[model samples]
Target chain A: MPLSSRPVSRRTTLAAAPLLALAGCRWGPAEDGDEPAAEPSNAVPDEQQVKAALQAIADADAFVKDVSADHVGLAEPLAALTALHTAHQALIAKEGDTGTTVRMGTPTRATAALKAVRRRELGLQRTLTKLAGEVSSGELARTLAAMAAGVAQQVALLPETAKDADA
Target chain B: MTGTDALQTTLAAEHAAVWIYGVLGGQTSQSSQPALYDAVTTAYVTHRSRRDQLVRWVRDADEVPVAAEVAYELPNAARTPAELKAIGLQVEQRCAAAYADLVGRTTEDERAWGVNALVESAVRQLDFDGDPTDLPGIDA
Candidate 1:
């Protein structure tokens, strides 16, 4: 689901305000004789990126469910892919939750669904990397990077590659 | 940590991986454990290639790449194929952690390389009989 659809708490918005201020600071000129403001020691995580990650997990769960219902042969690989998504969602949710609202999309055929998930995994990889760049917390940034790597590995294990592996 | 520092850490981890794989392949029985031996051989080549790439990256950035130790203490003697797999798995996990930190520290080309390294480490986790983790490097 989009961030707009999720009900972000008032506290969450307030918590993320410093990052918004940082974004705005990028536009303004420095005042004369004043040193640049020091970075906050405890900066908020990037809200939009967190929301998008949560959405990606929900999408993966729904798609895997759809594809698994129709294709038994694809089940094992899909399960592993789904597990990765689930684990990502759990970590992100624990960090700063804007509640997940499942927005289900139409499922394609087995091959197509695998391709679709691969595309989604690639998207997540990019998003997580961008998010890693934006966040101030070293720990959080490393976690995001690790998750991105997990997605990349999942992308490599798509249906076409699975067939290649068997061959 | 700074990008250079992270890169150095990764270089060290890769060095350790290359060393461990060499010891692992030397000690493990190739005739009795063909598949395990083959996997170790492939892993050794991959780590050697990565170690070389890391050296070039550090050199390109005008930084001194961390040198491999004369020897590393093995977690165990790794007398069996299973023990060798365990050692391989541990080294890959350490590499994943190092590369994950590098991903956060570096940008543009270096960051891209770090991402690929992290991914390769995670995939190698599977080859070593480790499960797919939600977070490869992170404890939580």
Candidate 2:
């Protein structure tokens, strides 16, 4: 088992069981010898939404890495933010998402880059919050909501200039 | 769990949080540790308001709200400001988890309320020197 495949395998096993359990009222027990019911209509859409959300995270991670690399002074301050994106990717990324690559545009000066990152972080928080409510699975919704809250915490601690940027 | 059950569980956590914050606020000094004092006081007031809101929500659903325990056992003696901050962090972490669970088990207005509470608790954790994480309530 390759290291990269670990999260995909975990998600594959964990996803179906919880949806069935949570939607128990809508899905009755299968009769003896009966074929498994058709896949839930919402499952594909939910996966697509999750993929898009994961892509957004990847983009942010790449941007942060680029900025940190260019501005050595920022490496320490942005370390937690990078770790946050990694943790989120682990939880939300699905099969095929591991190899996904996103193009992060050219970086600006350190101060400008930090402000831009802060804006993007806030934008990502909003995206996660909206997706949380839109998802069909309650469990996934909770995870996304928590992710948004996590972003909120980091956003709150950004440099004082970043705060001014928002205003 | 049912939505009602999630609400009751969160109500119970809020009860404990309110009591614990009260104790933490009392232990923190106003003059020497003004910053810690303000954090504890703010948390105390926020938890109290959240507890009251939970009670109203439970009653609105026609379910009996769970009552707070007469006292909650402190995790530590909390004799110093650092210890008090630790307790404050723990309380916010626990409440964040409860709010996350509530978000899953609810919808519409209740779910919105749960999301707001989870966000507030996550930010509050930083005041107590908590490390920011990828998932606030879930990881906590």
Instruction: Give the winner by lDDT.
Output: 2
Q: What DockQ does each candidate score versus the true complex, computed on alpha carbons? A: 0.15, 0.21
Please write out the lDDT profile of model 1 over residues A1-167, one tens digit for every residue.
Answer: 23333343212222221211111111111113222222366766566767766666666566676566666667777788777776666666644454544544534455665666677667777877777666655445666777876776667656684354234
Q: Using DockQ, give the best candidate's number.
A: 2
Task: Please write out the lDDT profile of model 2 over residues B1-140, one tens digit for every residue.
Answer: 57777788788888888888888877889999999999999998998998899899999999999888899888799998778889888888888877877777777778878888888999999999998876777666
Candidate 1 local Cα displacement, residue B102, angstroms: 1.3
Docking class of 2: incorrect
Which of the numbered candidates is closest to the native, going by highest TM-score? 2
Q: After aligning candidate 1 to the native by TM-score, how far in Å is the CA of B135 from where it should be?
A: 0.2
Tell me the TM-score of each prediction against the true structure: 0.69, 0.79
Judged by DockQ cut-offs, is candidate 1 incorrect, acceptable, medium or high?
Answer: incorrect
| Residue B1's lDDT in candidate 1 | 49
Give stretches of model 2 more than 4 Å off: A1-45, A98-107, A161-167
